[model samples]
Target: MADLGAGTGLFTRLLLSAGAARVDAIEPNPEMRAELEAALAAQVAAGAVRVHAGTSEATGRPDASADLVTAAQAAHWFAPEPTVRELRRVLRPGGRVLLVWNDWRGVDAPLNRAYGEVVAGFTEADVPPLATRVPEAELPGLLPGGFEKRLFDHAVPFTRERLRALAGSVSYLPSPGDPAYAAMTAALDRAFGEPAGGEAPLVYRTHAYLGRLDG
Candidate 1:
């Protein structure tokens, strides 16, 4: 499997656990690559994975060599045409391209609303979800030949730690030291309470777009 833009190897780790034979974690950001390396050290030592520093548009794998390719929450950063071509070049005939995204559902909920207000105060824009912006209408250009998409609805248990980590995962948020950062924290506190509603988690819609290359 190809794990594109594998930040800190989160999705890569999941793929490994799910028994993928091998995963080539492709990441372009240096700091993120370092984080990925640190996170996947044991996996690499166990011979479960390899890491490649590159972008989705230019994965260094041999042509038509991969059996399956997956980009988790990172394809949006790539320009569709080049990325699709690169993916096609590396995927074996009849291989599948799976695009995965974890979009938070019910963003209009009370807690979510407070979360958005904080982010908006800082960035002048709410932290727009990546999946919602995908060019589903122009998908033909993104997938050579044709493809199918599937929506996988799911939820992840969220706590203060997870929420904080989620906020940190985003690229635009002000750091904990920044002044606007306090506002975000305050917003989070107001929205989720000091400890967050017990174990009951927010649901997220995990959208999966599986596009196969023509044989």
Candidate 2:
């Protein structure tokens, strides 16, 4: 399996936990690759997870080398056409491509709604909304076969500090020293006020799109 844009090996670790024979974590960012290597050092040393500094369009892997190619929470950053071509190149005949994202379900609750507003306020205009960016209907045109969608509902309980950290993790959001950073932090504090249990819920609809290439 090839896990593209495997930041910090989050999905790579999941694959390992699920008993995958091997996983190639391909991350283009130097910092992210370094973190992934450090986080999964044991797996790397055991020859279970291999780290590659590569992008979705140029994986630097042999033809038909992977049985499955996966991109989790990272496909939005890729050029769909080139990524699909690259996936086809690296995947064996009839191999599958899986695109997954933890889609925030804002309408589910007040906490979720507030979180969405906080994110939107901080998010740059160049960043596209995940909800509308990848239209499920158009996925089939990008690959040999059409794609199938699966959704799983889940929630993460976040304390105030964790929520702030989560907000800070948004790539387009202003950093600590930036002028807008203070404002964003202020808004987050207001939106994610102290809950009775000291935590708030962030719900997600895990979206999975699976497609297979023609042999």
Candidate 3:
């Protein structure tokens, strides 16, 4: 199986745990790949997971080599047409491609709403929203064949500090040295205060889209 844009190997670890014989985790970011390697060192040494420096549009794997391809929370950065072609090239006959994302479902809740407001204040108008970029309705056209969509609901517990870190992790958000970083941090701190139980709920709808490629 080929895991494209396997940032930090989150889904790769799940695949390994789920009994995948071998997983090629392809990541272009050096820092993220380093972290993935460090976290999955034993798995790498065991020949269960192999790390590659590559991108979704050019995975560098031989044609028809992978039985399955997957991208988690990273497909939004890819160019749909070229990426679909690359996925098709790497996948064997009748192989499948799965695109998964953990969409936040607590937008209407108090803490989540406040957090959204804080992010919005810092987010640039030109940056496109992820959902619109990789819409479920359009996945079928983007793949070699049509696709199916599924959603699973889950919740994560996070403390105030974790919440702040989550907001800061957004790619488009200003970094520490940026002028807007201080204001963004202050706003996030105000919006997300310490919870009563020391942990707040972060509800998510895991969206999974699966499609197959023709031979």
Clash list (residue pairs), candidate 2 = none
| lDDT (Cα, tens digit) per residue for candidate 1, span 45-108 | 8777888888988999999778888888877787987887788889888888877777764444
lDDT of 3 by residue, 30-118 (tens): 99999999999999999999999999889999999999898898877788878888887898888899888887743456676777788
Per-model lDDT: 0.74, 0.82, 0.82
Which tens-of-lDDT digit does each residue in 80-189 have in candidate 2? 77888888889988789888888675347767898888878778888756543365665665445767788898878888777777777766788777898888878888
> Residue 75 lDDT in model 3?
79
Using TM-score, rank the candidates from best to worst.
Answer: 3, 2, 1
Candidate 3 segments whose C-alpha is farther than 4 A from its true place: 105-107, 131-133, 195-197
Give TM-scores for every candidate, taking all chains together and pairing residue i with residue i: 0.80, 0.88, 0.89
Clash count, one per candidate: 0, 0, 0
lDDT of 2 at 144: 52
Once fitted onto the true fold, the runs of candidate 2 whose alpha carbons sit more than 4 angstroms away are 125-127, 131-133, 141-144, 195-197
